[model samples]
Target: MIKRVHVLEDDEDIRYIIGVLLKDEGYELQLSSSFSDLKSKLKDSVPDLFILDVMIPDGNGTDICADLKNDIFTKQIPIIVMSADDKNKDKSLGAGADDYISKPFDIDHIVNRINKLLVK
Candidate 1:
């Protein structure tokens, strides 16, 4: 099955880069640059995985992750927290993110992590 990935990131450059990197990997991507946009996108469909940036303009991804994890419908979906704040790893994990990736991330490593999470 082609895994669907929803990326909630406010950084335009990083978001574009991630989208490009995953485009050829056969995963369906739903990219949102804002909290409202992400919510709107989720209203229509839920992706198999969620890749979130910890710091966003309107809200933090950790909170979003927590909300999703608490939701019966979205609880099973794996979440990957990508952030520039390395200190937030523990917090993100505590918030129910399945994986954490620090900023200035290596594309190959991110891909490997995503693959591993998808397999689980």
Candidate 2:
């Protein structure tokens, strides 16, 4: 089965790049530019994994990560929190994210992490 991945990134170019790369890897990719958009998508179905950007226009990714972790339904989903500022790594991990990635990230690294997390 194809693994599903939901990504929330405010930057259009970054989102597009990630989408293309993940799609190329044969994972089903869902892209959202805002927290509200991601929430709406979540209502349809939960993805196997989530890739969230730390700072967004409407909400913070760490807060969303914490919320997901707190919810019984979504708590099991692996989450990868990323940021342009490397200092936010601690904040991301503290929020219950499974992994943290620094922005301008290596696509191979992100893809490998996703593969590892979804290997169950």
TM-score of each: 0.96, 0.97
Off by over 4 Å in 2: none
**Which pairs of residues collide in candidate 1?**
none
Cα displacement (angstroms), candidate 1, residue 117, comes to 0.9
Candidate 1 Cα misplacement greater than 4 A, ranges = none
Model 2 clash pairs are none
Error of 1 at 115 (Å): 0.8
Write candidate 2's Cα lDDT for 27-77 as tens digits: 998999999999999899999999999999999999999999999989999
Clashes of 2: 0
Query: Compared to the true structure, candidate 1 yields what TM-score?
Result: 0.96
